[model samples]
Target chain A: MVKVVFTDHAGSEQSVEVATGVSIMEAAVSNGISGIDADCGGSCSCATCHVYVDKAWLGKLDAMNPDEDAMLGLSTDRQDNSRLSCQIRLRDELDGIAVTTPEFQF
Target chain B: MSDSIVNEEIDRRPESKWSMVGKDPYSMPLEKIDLAHPGIWQENEFLPFLKRLREEAPVHYCAESATGPYWSVTKYKDIMEVDTSPHIYSSEPTIGIVDAYEQFTIPSFISMDPPKHDEQRRVVQGVVAPTNLKALEGLIRQRAQTILDGLPIGEEFDWVERVSIELTTQMLATLFDFPFEDRHKLTYWSDVATAIPGGGIIDNNEQRWAAMEDCLATFTRLWNERINAEPGNDLISMLAHGEATKNMPPMEYLGNILLLIVGGNDTTRNSITGGVLALNQFPEEYDKLRSDHSLIPNMVSEIIRWQTPLAYMRRTAKVDTVLNGQQIKKGEKVIMWYASGNQDDEVIENPERMIVDRPNARQHLSFGFGLHRCMGNRLAEMQLRIVWEEIMQRFERIEVVGEPERIYSSFVKGYAKMNVVLHPKKAA
Candidate 1:
């Protein structure tokens, strides 16, 4: 299991142990972490799962694609580190990664 | 006697190059029922055949000249994968199943990527905040009951055509702030927009253009009205007043309203009729529902799962990515089947069977997930639950007397017409 911390737009913290294979959105939802609604079930269409990954690990993981960039822009209060949690898979290197939720999912 | 006419395969074009069920696995004759004709599509096809396709390839792929034979992503897990991965997959190319013309751009923020998508959705969301959604609830419920109240006292009517459509239209009218008298136009326009080939729900392009033009004109009127008036809480009002983001242009507002129509209209209508159908097929389950009303919420989720209303939401790949060991190139279409994913055995037990209290009800992909999840989901459930409650109190028995039909649409999947004979309840 990978240990990850999730921070919301308000900066609330949710520390949980995520399985290696699950996506960041899955980990947050199954654990009952608030903020990420994920209405489309992780489809790129719905921006409900918008998150801002802690910049510490931004360099280690893949960069946001055009779709991801576009979706983040759709989110409320998106930061430069904004990323769709569903796009970030949990790998060993991403174990300490943290993500902050957006102000709104609509 | 209730009759059901279902056909998994609607109209087949001989030149179709894709085959999803057979030999090449990637190519199969396009086999899908038009959902507009609820009577025949549900009765003769849809369900039973969806089961067969599941058995063959949990992840079936097909093409119908729209997206040039894209992946179906049929299995529950696979569909979820497609839905979950926004960066790797997208909604750009073929927003849904129907392949529109190159120049034809629908202001479907749902299908757009972020920056722009976010601002537009934000504008709408602002209008539908919890407070707004709550206020609309009582009114919507009342509207639903009023429509039900008007149904034939003791006759089995076509629930989809009568109850569901009327209920949804009234709710939409509130959202659009259109006068209640013009409610039918909303239904008519929405129906024409989602009308598929199998059900003949739509007329030719001229007819479609006329209806769309009318809708556009009405929206223009609304926008101008809002622009003139100060911003209020309503969606159109909020959008008119809200500052457009750098990406969301002011011109796209009218088109965005149309997107809201399709997003809200077809999805709820299908879910409503699908809920009734699920109850009809699972009599024992329905009985359970009749006895314990609390399960209405779960039942709503199950119906959305069973119906999987909006069929395949198309996403284009923004970059080359590997899924299930397959190499997907950039700009390729990845059609996610939320309906198929809701039934994945891995995620839900006996995915085919409708479990009223299925503990993990959120697993279904009906509302979608990720950044682009459905905005009207909460209201949808509220409407469905109230509809069922009224049915339980007012109906003794409702059975299909004539064959049901389905929408020919590859996108919105639902019953176009379902005839039923309702045994009205006598005074307690």
Candidate 2:
């Protein structure tokens, strides 16, 4: 299992032990964590799963694919650390990685 | 499967494609792809043809079709591009490839562009808002339990009518605060609103028009009643009191009514039926589900993804645009095949199989995207979750006794009749 923390826009934090191979979005949804609607599932389509990875662990994740990059580009609150949670699969090295969800995901 | 609800004669025309069912769809040239014909879907043979289009020509154009020429956006990324880019690919003119029966075009916000669309949609958005959804959850679960408990055990019955349509129509009735006793009328009006002329319940344009008129008259009566009543939580009351919706013209009112009914009905209804059929088809998956009931919510998303209830949503090109290297001219109809996109191998790990616990199961394009994304989406998901939860508690297995009778229209990928025999779980 991979341990991950999700911080919603309201600043509430949820730490979940997600099964390995599951994306961070899956962990949030299974735990019923709010702030990430992930409307399009994890197809890297709907940016509802947008999240800002904690700067400390940003370098550990894979580079954003063009599709995820383009979708995040459409987000109004996108930041340099912005990454769609659906695109971020949980891994051992990222055991304590934290990500913050935007206030609203259109 | 028995004969479809729609008459077979309607598909016997010389130009109809029903006769080509046995032919290998993959062998056909990409240019020959026409996803509009309902016959192909009624026969349950649309998958391979769409797969071919999605693989060989993701943005292929069909110059000749029952609904006239249009572009098919088959891949997941391209579909996202078109569905999200509402300005470049207009939803106006109509979301269905074929224009609304020329004589009966009621303009709804789903087919309108922004500003106007956003203003009108806000009126009823509260009905499915998070707070409203929280309040509705208990009511939905109770109704689901009642509906599931009432079904006969070990008897073959049409799941579509008995379970799917019944629950959704009941939800629609609750949303509208419509008369409980007259809830069946909601189903009838919704069917008539979507059925093609000379197909199924509607046999002619006159019959279709009369049904619309009746729908208008009935809703107008409700509108007048709510217009004077104290503000309530129902959709009618919301519209009656909303600044942007209060003075909508007769046709626009009818348009919004159809939008809510079809939106609230088909997606959940079909997913309910499809989930059962899918579980039966992949028995191992059924075992996986039976072994772990915790997967119910995830299974609901998987079911919606697999069903892709509304096969496609048509958009008109607002201006010349280059899509996936294909040139699209202004005023051209572009069909975004959500069903095809959901199964695109490039995105979905195993696009063909049914896996209840797919990690990113919610990533399907079934509800569409952009400003016109389904407003009742969360509500739809909640209802499915409740129904399946209630089903699992009562029955060990829902045995498919006969082939399912699919809805005749390619537009609404659903079943009209699905025979199932319930096997209740023995008490411990």
Candidate 3:
């Protein structure tokens, strides 16, 4: 199992443990974490599951696919570290990765 | 104006069109069921036909209809697949079931493929983005209170006109920074944009073209005025200064303006009306809502699902592809029936009923999935949330007093007139 931490816009933090292969979105959703809508259910279509990965772990994640890049491009709050959580599958190396959720999902 | 006159008009029309209107969904051969007829939708008889399609043939083809030959995709998963895969199912030419006429065509991002779609959409999406909504919320709530407080308690009024149309039109005016007095023109142009010819709103294509011309002229004046001024926060100013859209041709500017106007207008207007009618239809759900006002946000999503305001979005097959074992030829029209997909029992439990706290209610397809998903979705949700919140504080119930009148098009599944009476909240 790997540990994932989610910090909401209000600065509340939630940590959850889940087996590898599940996406960070599924992890946050299953743990009843607020701020992650995941409206498209991980299709990378809806940008609702957006997150800002903690700067340290940003290099460890998979490269953003063109679809994810295009989707994030439409977000007004998008930052350099922004990523759609559904695109990031949990892996052994991603253990203890922390991210923050925006106040509202567009 | 009356049912008999409308029926006589349909009867007098050529039999070749609207042949499927009065036919039974089950008794008729499966191949004979045509879902595009505006008659079934306006009459609220489209559900049975959609159910039959989902049960028997999820990706059935209609060989004949008023529009032409087209494929109906009725399942939830299949819709997700087609919506996400824009390369296979292109949105170009036009998204409407009817083919586009060269003179009337307006170039908006909703019907365009990516690169260009991505560029133009980026320029204006921020106007309704969630951050901007936070600033607009207090104003929206203020407006809702004004509209609701003025309502006549215990007396009949058209909810569509009094509450739904009025609030949404006012909101659109604020979004565009449009002239407050002429805001009614925004609502009229939006209706005409999606109206079907020979339907109640318009008599023929020429009338629609004239209305479009007037809309274009009015907006052109707004654009010229805003383009030379300091950039403001409104949509017109944003478009006037937007890098991707600033140099666009007159028709494209009008197209994008009409897109925002209609997108911002008709959709939420109907949902506002639909929520009142749906709550009355399911009294138990209303009781649950009255007891716990905390459910407003979740209920907003459930309302959108139950309403599914815009019925379906048309996508043309970019290449010869097989979807759910049915081979769709290149350039054929494929209609994604979101109205059917929302009720597909496979994804939603008790798909027919309106459960206020229904789990994952936001997952519904009212805002079609993928690249072309409704950009103003967050704004729509915010408007509904504020309206309902203010409503609960003032009214015990907004009762649907009489039968609701529906719009004439199948594409826009919404109400035209719904008589309602408001019951004031009793003191604690």
Candidate 4:
């Protein structure tokens, strides 16, 4: 299992563990984390699953695909480290990854 | 195009002779069912026909209709597949059931494919983005209060006119930085843009074209005024200075403007009216709401699902594709029935009931899915949320005193007239 920490807009953090193969979006959703809406059910279509990767762990995650980049562009809250959690799969190398959810999902 | 040319084109087009009105769903043959007809929709008799289609033929085809042959995708999952795979199911030329005539068609991002679609959508989407809505919330609440406070208690009034139309029109005007006094023209043009010819809003295509010309002229003046000014937060200013849109031709500019105006206007207006009607129909749910005001946010989503305003969006098949075991050929029209999918019992439990606190209400198909999903979704939600919050504070109940009249078009599902009486809260 890989560990993931989700920090909400209010600075509240919730930690959860899930199998390594599942996406970070699934881990957050299955663990009942408050911030991630994942409205498109992890298709990377809706930008609702957006999260800002912690700067320390940003390089550890896989690169953003064209679809993810396009979807994130529509968001007014997009930032330098912004990523759609659905596009990131949990892996042992990224076991202690931390990300923060935006206040609102566009 | 000149008025004489427009008249000639209108005269050449044939009128729709087929209608599904007064037809019994159970008695009709399976292949004979056509959901495109505005007859059953305006009468509020579309549910059974939609149910029949979802059960028997999830991806059914209609060979002969006013809009020509098209496939009806009623299941939620099937609709999702079609929506997400834009490469297979393209949104081009037009998204309406009826094919666009060369002279009448106005090119907009909604009907364009990717690269171009992405570029154009990115330019104006920020206007209604969540961050922008935060700024708009205060203004929206103040307007809602003014409109609601003006209502007469214990007296019958047309809620559709006084509240729904007025509130949404004001909101639209604010978005465009339009003159508040002439805001009613936005509502009229929106109605005209989506109006089905011979559907009471307009007698024929000529009238529809004439109204559109007037809309174009008005918006053109707004564009010219804003183009050289300092960049502002309003939508018109955004488009006037937008890199991808600034150099667009006159027809394209008018098309995009009409798209935003109609997109912002009718959908929410009907949902506003629909919420009152839905709560009246489901008094127990209304009781649930009165007891816990926290349910207001969730209730807003349920109301959107129940209304399913702007019932279906049309996509043309780009290639020979098989969806849900049904074959859709190249260049054929595929209509995703959001109204039916929202009520698909397989996905939503007790699909017909208006539960105030229904879980996963935001997952409904009302705003659609994939690339062309409604850009103004958050704005619409905020407007509904604020309206409900202010409403609970002031009125005990918004009672629907009479039968609500529905709109004529199958595309824009909403109320045309609804008599309502406000009941103020008894002092605690």
Best by DockQ: 3
Instruction: Give the per-residue lDDT of model 2 (tens digit) for A40-98.
Output: 66767667888899999999999987767656654546789999998888888989899
> Candidate 3 on B1-428: residue-level lDDT in tens?
12221222222122335646777889998988888778788778888999999999999999977677899999999999999999999888778787654212477888899989989999999989998999999999999999998999998999999899999999999999999999999999999988876678876556777888899999889999999899999999999999999999988998899889889999999999999999999999999999999999999999999999989988999999999999999999999999999999999999889899999999999998888889999999999999999999999888898689998777889999999888999998
B272-355: candidate 4 lDDT, tens digit per residue: 999999999999999999999999988998999999998998899999989988888999999999999999999999999989
Candidate 2: pairs in clash: A40-B362, A40-B363, A41-B362, A41-B363, A42-B363
- Against the true structure, what is model 4's DockQ? 0.70
Ranking by TM-score: 3, 4, 2, 1
Q: Each candidate's chain B TM-score?
A: 0.85, 0.95, 0.96, 0.96
Runs in model 3 with CA error above 4 Å? B1-16, B102-104
Docking quality (DockQ) for each candidate: 0.26, 0.15, 0.83, 0.70
Q: Distance (Å) between predicted and true CA of A77, model 1?
A: 12
Worst 10 residues of 4 chain A by lDDT: A34-43
Query: Per-candidate interface C-alpha RMSD?
Result: 4.5, 6.0, 0.9, 1.2
User: Mind giving the per-residue lDDT tens digits that candidate 2 earns over B1-428?
Assistant: 11232233334232466334566887777687677777778889888988888878999899976667889999998998898787798878788866645322478888888768878887887787555777989999999888898999988888999999999999999999998899998898888777767557676556766777888899999999999999899999999999999999988999998889888988789999999999999999999999999999899989999999999998999999999999999999999999899999899988888899987787788988766777787788889888988888889999998789887777889998999999999898
Q: Candidate 4 chain B: worst 10 consecutive residues by lDDT?
A: B5-14
Give the chain A TM-score for each candidate. Answer: 0.89, 0.96, 0.98, 0.97
* TM-score, one value per model: 0.75, 0.84, 0.96, 0.96
- Tell me the RMSD of model 3 versus the true structure: 3.8
